[model samples]
Target: MLENEFVTFSQNFLDRSGNHRSNQKKINEYLCKNSAQYLIYWRGKVPVVSDVRDQLCWVGRDHPLVLNYSGMPTFLGLENDIPFFSINISSWLPGNYNEAAAGAFFDSNIYNHPDLPESSFFAELRGFMNRISAREAELAVMTRGINVWQENNLYCSKCGNLTEIINAGWQRNCVNCGAFHFPRTDPVVIMLVTHGNNILLGRSHGWPDKMYSCLAGFMEPGESIEAAVQREVLEETSILVKNVRYLTSQPWPFPSSLMIGCVAEALSKKVLIDPKEIENALWVSREEMLEAFSGNNERIYPARVGSIAHFMIKKWLSGSIE
Candidate 1:
């Protein structure tokens, strides 16, 4: 990949003002500022213009939606000194809400708030992630990741006591035990395992038909990135790899994960299936991968656009995986 190129959610677009996170006075000042922008989220979905899904629907601090929400908004970061925050209004229910659709792998349903503009609808970030700019993607993912963490970790793990948001939503403090907890990000190793002219690809059991990407697994405790890459590949595909090297990284916040991308040279090519680990695994030649990317392959669909897998594969195909 080019030096300046970055995958979705990987760009440094916002100055996360860590210094001001602990300052209650500063945070309150930003919240009261008329120019402060807020991104409203509902059940992990953000509002975007239906006609053109290029930008997030940002509202001022005094917007009815903000005024109606009683919960505190999490401070995201600063963009050119303009404070950005995210508020969750998941309590509000829409007339056309489909619970099943909202919980799907990719929610296709669009929900419009009665108080908001007709063109603005809450949509899954993955649905229009590629359509928005890098800065917007970063903001959306940060908001979603933080909100998900807060919702799931309402109680302290150490003491099982209710926790309260502190440090401008950056940390949580236990009301009873006084233990402080921070947002957690699990590390995962996603590797492009190659044997000569072929690259390794695998698909999970319930992935869309023909949609395959690089082999990946969560990194184990006390394991290094290189060691995790080898162990995961061996366990999942029965393939041994050597010369493991790090590539780029992406912050994948589906539920808070840091995808550590790598390139490895396969030492053995024999195929061995692990049904529980993955539905199927295969080695695709460069020619076939190119054809798949161009939509000419009959049995293969490349990774989703704007994903690190897609970025890594494209880089490899262009002979840029250095």
Candidate 2:
């Protein structure tokens, strides 16, 4: 489907991106034309969504601090064809803008910015991404990933000291030690394990009722993706898997995770569910899956539409994943 076409965010794209079409000359020319760049900010875990939660509100576009693009500020990468840049408001805007002085950034749920409109708040980035270039959306996701990584990794693992932003927010430098830290994306393996007429699906706690998805687990240190898939399925559902094959990957930015999609052959038919990892596990037949996809089956519900779990399962049912 068209929903999954531009969904795959590859590592090669991120590794080679950043200022792809912008040179000093082009950047300056664009800035001189009164076209401004904005940095969309999120507080705590909640993205600053609009009242309707439809679009992400932009700062410095026509706000209290009208930022000029010609003058340099920190870039947060281009998201949806719009260049995002963060300015040290204290350094750029001249006024009494300091509300809380506890290092300018905090990680808590506070009730401020009450007057801002939803249009100036959080955005369903996926929906807005359709209007922009692929590379721009990818960059925006990366910036958000970097922000999440920085928030979680404030305290260093090597030394119990706070880290400072360096490399233009790409890397962090620890003041206590000379260690440099980079962003981290945890790798998880999500597979549609199948044999003959059935495919394995499991549901975790806190999920919607009757909903199931491909089994997934983090790839542990020094473990391969194939081994991780087999191990996860076997551990959670007690189903032995063989001939595991890699299919595709998705950049799941719900706090920064890279999902590795796969298809594994089920070596055993019996299922022994691990209550700790799953609320329930089942092997549904092709006919049942078709019903689920068509929304006619009351026994099971497919995974959320935008997720790779849904994509993998749909592909499997259509005989396209074999």
lDDT of each: 0.90, 0.65
In candidate 2, which residue pairs get closer than 3 Å at backbone N, Cα or C atoms, i.e. clash?
48-121, 48-122, 49-121, 49-122, 50-118, 50-121, 50-122, 51-118, 57-120
Error of 1 at 227 (Å): 0.5
Which stretch of 10 consecutive residues in model 1 shows the poorest summed lDDT?
1-10
Please state the error at residue 305 of candidate 2 in Å. Answer: 1.2
92-181, model 1: which lDDT tens digit per residue? Answer: 998889999877677888899987778898998888999998889989999999999998899999989999999988899999999989
Q: Which stretches of candidate 1 lie above 4 Å from their native place?
A: 1-4
Off by over 4 Å in 2: 1-36, 44-62, 65-74, 78-82, 86-120, 123-140
**Tens digits of per-residue lDDT for model 2, 40-72:** 434322233434433334454554444433334
**Residue 188 lDDT, candidate 2, scale 0-100:** 96
Residue 58 shift from truth in candidate 2, angstroms = 4.0
